[model samples]
Target chain A: MTVLGYLANGLVFSSIIVLGSIGLSLVYSIADFANFAHGDTMTIGAYTALVTFGAVGGLGGAVLGLPYGFFLALVVGIAVAAVVAVGTEKLIYEPLDVDSIGLLITSIGIAFIYRAVIQIRFGSDFTRFGIQSLRPIETLIPYGVRVTLHDVAIVASAVVLVAGLHVLLQYTDLGRKMRAMADNPDLARVSGIRTKRVKLWTWVIGAGLAGAGGVFLGLFNQLSPRMGFNLLLIIFAAVILGGIGSVYGAMAGGFLIGMITQLTPFFSNVVEALPIGQGWLATLLENLITLEYANAIAFVIMVVVLLVRPNGIAGEGAT
Target chain B: MSLLADPKAAFADLTRPERWVLGVSVAFMLFLLGALLTGALGPTYFLFLVGLAGMYALLSFGLNAQWGFTGLINFSVAAFFGIGAYGSALMTAESSPIAGGFNPLVGLVVALVVALVLALLIGIPTLRLRADYLAIASLGLAEVVRLVVLNERWLTNGSAGVRGIPSFFKGWPVLSTFPETMPGLRLVVIPGSPIILGTSFWEALLNVLLVLTFAGVTFLMLRRAHQSPWGRVLRTIRSDEDLARALGKNTYSFKMQSFILGSLIMALAGVFYTHLNLYVGPGDLDPITTFYAWVAVILGGSGSNRGALFGGIVIVTIREGTRFLNDFAIPIDPAPMRLLLIGIVIVAVMRYRPQGVLPPQRELIWPSAVDGGGTTETPDSGVREQKGGGGDE
Candidate 1:
């Protein structure tokens, strides 16, 4: 039961990583800039969700009395996504016009500006939305198997988002244009496609997904001004490990990273049974590795995978 | 065709009287230092600042040889610096099973050897991929190193840090021999009468000798290297990689060498850092430390060895000065203003004079040489140079 509980927890965590990184890949593909602000886009969404839910009287006043906090998160998430989408294109991405070095420098500037603004306003401390909503269901599972309603939201939302992405890319005319442009912008432009429109639509959907992922993440963890900044490294590793521009690769990379992190403690328990048993290794990790640093576990996975396969598991163009 | 092909013309041009002014400037500095010692200023604190700046200049020289010469953006300076400090600490001190069942001297040697191996480890994999991947990977690697340092308390003493190091240059003894705590003087606050970073006279004396030895070696080696054919290849690679490749050079190996060498130099600085503080902590090597090096190199003019030294002095002075200046009844908030000023300097230099001050591989040609081709092959070749990192392919 504990293993299963761990698996559930892993999946919940993986869903957020996958979602966050997939946006990274999309923006990288479209804008051709490593948007350092992509993670902050998540912060913006999380903060917006909090504000939106507050306006809606805490998501519990609805008829079903179901976990409506997530429902509120969706609306606010989309709105934040739309705002950043239009804003970045108008204010940041479009103005830069795909110069790699310029884009890189400007994105760094954008990140600092975003961080400074967030800090000035939010005061650099962790704030949490209530988690009492998940307490009762967590106690009922055997193997002491525990799952929060927030975990349920993350897993369920991830499935819905991934499916929606797959269908959108496969079935829609807009996705068709985006894929065409991603393949070759010159050819797409020559083929009479409106690349700018496709890019705008891409950012809207991509950043909206980032926003939803942020809300899911913030619900599980606490929200701080620099909350998503550290997580960006792990997310980038996932994106690269998955493949630079692939969505599904990001998903696989995320879950792989998630399981590796959870399984470290699992390894310690297994080793404790050995003859030279040093429970010290596990206890040392617990004492020394801060929760903030747990995010970097994904980078090791990424560096290893990147060295082995720069093209990623799905290969190029396939993502 | 003129100066570009003739090394004699460039060497002869440096013999002029006005050019001697730059040489005389060094001598002038020596005289001024001599005066400041006996004069009203005393120059104790200023000398300390200069010593620290000289150490940083060596660090900047290493970085300049890497980034200025090789065109790499090493975002991992702090990690390498920490590695060096830990290396130095372990080498010069005594340790027991208390620190991972191994001695620090053994760890120090192991650390330096692994550093070169680590550079190759980081370089070979990422070098074949995008350059930015190296930047990202290196940043990630720094976090891993920091985490390992923190977690392996068995090795690093964990976040509380390792302390009680035997000082290599402990203190100056001769100049500070007059003990104020002696019954004759009665000058002691309590006893022993401490001065010079609050170290005993012997420790300060030792530090001066050690700092001078390290500084002398760095200054000479960098000067010798600057004039070598290898340095010429580096300048060419920085200007245009493909052109260098077209000239029958393998750019990658040189880049790898520069990276490892630069990292080793930073490691040396790290050793001094650990000994100076008598401790090693994870938080000591932050990104700000790396940027300080960048500021030094840029402020000093990227390719100039002497410029790096001067730049280090200027930047440290600005940083320390602004902090000290906060004590006055100033009406301005210099915190954000200072950051904005630094940012502007970066942007301004990049826009106007990207070759930086004291541009290396000095060959006087019109702007046309900035493009390798004649007027005939105008359009496509020009486009290629910009997009393709000026490979001349």
Candidate 2:
């Protein structure tokens, strides 16, 4: 594929990653814990949509090659994911008396529970939505960019959700309270902000976005027991690269990381074409810059970022 | 000797909960012994279980050193374990892509050196950051290692895995042929169901001996280090890094040492596992193994060596018990059940008993300092108390 083809694919993949990173970053700031269950929360959303679509059926007409029922399934997926996160917080995280690291460990347990329950119900196999797959648009293929209408729909919906979030954060009362709590929970609570309520809302918004990301991811690829978990570290890399607590930074970081992951094959091709002498250096680059090492490349980038810029790219001050 | 004669007086120092734990452990061991004598559990399988427990104990020891003592959250436990397994497997397995037919002792050496280098590579970047950064980076390191193993077919044999691995005592003069040389024995323990001690049983006994050696040496080394001024410095770093730094301790260097030490122990467990299983695969490096060690350390009581050992045995029970349940009792799969059990244990432990079932309960001052003072100091005001609530930051 041409560079444009890879770029298009990156755009679609980045949309899902951006959706995931935003939730993780928000919770990290407001909830005050690196929730390991956030990825499983995405899995919850995807499976919920899978069951919803199977139950609801086509519901008549279609748009962008997806049935109306799929959209309904998407909404249901988001709602269920939000409800589950809230339930876990109320029943587990709230009553517990431990520091953030303790909560972090607890979150791993939560992640396992979510995944095990899913595996019990669904079995450890891959499945897809009832919606039929679509082919790349003919006009785009001629221009060396091949993306189906489904991919466009995913990107468009992500943009709409992200824009909605931007307006909410910049203008709305709840968003302001969330931002305030993210900045300093004690100050916000002292200033009459109901921190608990804000925290609950953060779970809702973060998990809700993650749910949408999960739905899009299932549509982009096949849904499996490990689908969300497999993507989790990459999402974490995105969140960290953007600064853990910053939502806007998460978007940029998600985009860059997602692009790099998808463009690894193209990068390898470029390396093969480069005339940078014939020695161990050339051989090393050729061996390392392959598609199989795509995720490894992202992880390496994350470690490097941790070393040079521990606070992340958009972090305001030293942590 | 007096305590053995008067059990009640021996138990006087232990708390009520500690006494209960001790009673339950004794009862459980007796039950297992009864089952073995009845010929219900095969001797070979029983010996294998012991070796598995010892291996897990070694893994837990490694994590205890890093997470328990030094407060470094190294999430790449499985990576070190996998590197150890792969390191040894590549050196000794017939199907190894690079080189094979090497001595198992050489494999052990290579595994430790590789683990040491990898530890330094990963620790140097994240140890300087906040505690959580180490957690994140180490997790990434695990994934990277797993991917490399899975993709680099030429180096690791990819998903096909390395097989034809010899036993741990492959090169030993007498031990190499000991299993074959020894005559098989059969005891009619239960009339029709005689307890058989065949070649496999002898081989398993040898594996158990090997693991015991590894775990025993690791335990002694850790005990000595953990009770010294050096371990006191690490505990201080765990509870309060600034305090240790203020006292002119180089916390970074101490953390690196702890990280490397723990990683080496985990690698040692891996080397043992490769010999025990006689094969190594990329799937062996799954993140589940890392969490298994985490569960072992936290549930066993962080910073407590005996607790880690207890936790390791408990983990093996949970792991093997689920398989046993699936085989005979229920039709349900064991994998999800094990995950659920692990999940519940973690959440319950955090919620109810965050200090764990057997938290460390002794002071860590230098033995010489206390001996020279010649004053009886209360053990109550020990490392756990100084650790305050929530052992980790």
Second chain alone, TM-score for each candidate: 0.68, 0.92
lDDT of every predicted structure (CA atoms): 0.65, 0.91
Per-residue error at A227 for model 2, in Å?
A: 1.0
Measured by TM-score, the strongest candidate is 2
RMSD in order of candidates:
9.4, 4.7
lDDT of 2 by residue, A1-319 (tens): 8999999999999999999999999999899888899899999999999999999898999898888999999999999999999999999999999999999999999998998899888988899887778888999897789899999999999999999999999899999998888888899999999999999999999999999999999999989878888888999999889988899989889999999999999999999999988989899999999998999999999999988887789885211
Clashes of 1: 17
TM-score of chain A of 2: 0.98
Compare the candidates by DockQ and give the number of the best one: 2
Q: How many clashes in candidate 2?
A: 0
lDDT of 1 at A5: 67
Instruction: Report, to 2 decimal places, the DockQ of model 1.
Output: 0.20
In terms of docking quality, model 1 is incorrect
